[model samples]
Target: MGEDCNLHEQACAAVLAPGVAVTLDISPKPVRAMTDLEFTVSLSDRNGPVDGAQVALDLSMPGMFMGENRSILSGLGNGLYQGKGVIPKCPSGKTLWRGDLQVQVGDVTGNVWFLFSVK
Candidate 1:
């Protein structure tokens, strides 16, 4: 839901469900293509950090075919999950990328779209 948001400068947040919220942060600011990148996803609600949730992120270039790149993140307690992935550099020199984040807790599932750019 953050197509106009610039995650390269700071963390961005989105609502995944009625009480579930998600925040995304990318390390090594000014994210670059064809490089290893770290993704941090935080899930929480009014009650505080959620725990034991499964999180997966899929990265792809919009309006372009870049193959399938998915990252499975490990739970790090307190609803914080971390994973590593890489985005291939587009031959057309485009830096815009989109992440499809899926969160599963018990039988409930939530999804969100995150728009970001790379160097």
Candidate 2:
């Protein structure tokens, strides 16, 4: 039973792809469901913030197939990208939400997922 529970938790957790280096900041922490949410994604490397990159956000709940809720983020100059979105209310009563930031800088592409709980 414990193993099964652990597996479920892991399945619901967010995952970051290897070799991806980026930071994400979500405004209005302690995200509330059915509310407006904003996010900032910063891509960087050894040199500095990565420029000329296309970024997007994919919001979903793990372990549930409710289609894809995605948003295209606009670059705010430098390596920072900003976008606005909303966390839909889960019909299954699950409060865990995952936000996957998809980044494409030149030939390199990667994703980082951030998980948060909704009240």
Candidate 3:
């Protein structure tokens, strides 16, 4: 399946599964291409931080292939995960990119998508 299709599937699965709230914080807002991008993923459920969960980030531009830019995040206690990655410049000059944050804790899985522009 294409990346876009896969992303849609993940979003749907996340909705159908138990609610998993995700909060994202990207450093140096107004992210620019070919630059360092740091992000923090915070996972939480009904109880509290979903610690020890496997978290990963898939960064891509819709309809644009720039290879697979995936990063595995390190769990920082209290439901917080951190990772860094660089946004590649789009050959088509598209500045908008989609970030898919996938979280998996045992049998439960959740996904969150965010749109950001590259200067």
Per-prediction TM-score, please? 0.94, 0.79, 0.81
Candidate 2: misplaced stretches above 4 Å? 1-20
The 0-to-1 C-alpha lDDT of every candidate, in the order given, reads 0.89, 0.69, 0.73
Error of 3 at 88 (Å): 0.5
Per-residue lDDT of 1-119 in model 2, one digit per residue for the tens?
11222221232222233444676666666567778877777777767667788889898887887577888888887778888888788888988777777888778888767666677
Model 3, 22-118: lDDT tens digits are 7666665556788887778878788987898888989998788889999889999998899999989888888878888788898987777776566
Cα lDDT of candidate 3 equals: 0.73
lDDT of 2 at 114: 67
lDDT of 1 by residue, 1-119 (tens): 88767788887899989988999888878888878899999999789998888999999988998999899988899889999998898889888889999999877799898888888
Candidate 3 residue runs with Cα over 4 Å from true position: 1-17
Residue pairs that clash (backbone atoms under 3 angstroms), model 2: none
Residue pairs whose backbone atoms clash in candidate 1: none
- Most accurate candidate by TM-score: 1
